[model samples]
Target: MKKIAILLALSVALSAPAWAATKAVTLSISGMTCGVCPITVRTALQRVPGVEKVGIDEAKKQVTITYDYSKTNVQALTRATKDAGYPSSIKQGERDHG
Candidate 1:
């Protein structure tokens, strides 16, 4: 019975989703020239599949994004923003939220 319990626990652990790893990065957004720019940028970023959070500063032309690392990557994030009419580039430093 003890062996069976141990196996079950191990199986559960292995089956659990490994996509919890989160990455946070500040993106420099270009082409935001008006009051409605932030809204567009926010909407664009939120549309990404794994984006968990988005923080936008219109004055600074920056957007901070937190997303699941396994389901998405930096390229996809940038592409999404660009496709939304706000081109983005990853900043120099990155933060990892575990």
Candidate 2:
């Protein structure tokens, strides 16, 4: 009975959820020409699951997004922006940050 209980406890522990770390990435955006562009971009990024924060730089035409690594990725971030009418790519030389 003790052995069975130990095995059960071990199995439960192994099956527990693994929490993912937060990650951030910057993307170079295109087609943001007007004042409302940043708002649009922010909204798009925020709609993605796991997105925690979004910062937009209009003058630099870039956006930095923080998100949960398990729930999202750079591809999802770029896709969100593209769907919002402003396509984007990862900013050169900038890697995903935690």
List the candidates' TM-scores in order: 0.76, 0.79
Candidate 1, superposed: residue stretches over 4 Å from native? 2-19, 92-98
Query: Best candidate, lDDT-wise?
Result: 2
**Please, what are the lDDT tens digits per residue for candidate 2 over residues 1-98?**
99999999998888754445899999999788899999999999999999999999999999999999888999999999999999999999989989
Cα lDDT computed for each candidate against the true fold: 0.83, 0.92
CA shift at 53, candidate 1, in angstroms?
0.5
The 10-residue segment with the lowest total lDDT in model 2: 12-21
- Residue 98, model 1: lDDT of 42
Q: Quote the positional error of residue 26 for candidate 2 in Å.
A: 0.4
Kindly report which residue stretches of model 2 are placed more than 4 angstroms away from their true locations once superposed. 1-19
Candidate 2 residue-wise lDDT at 71: 89
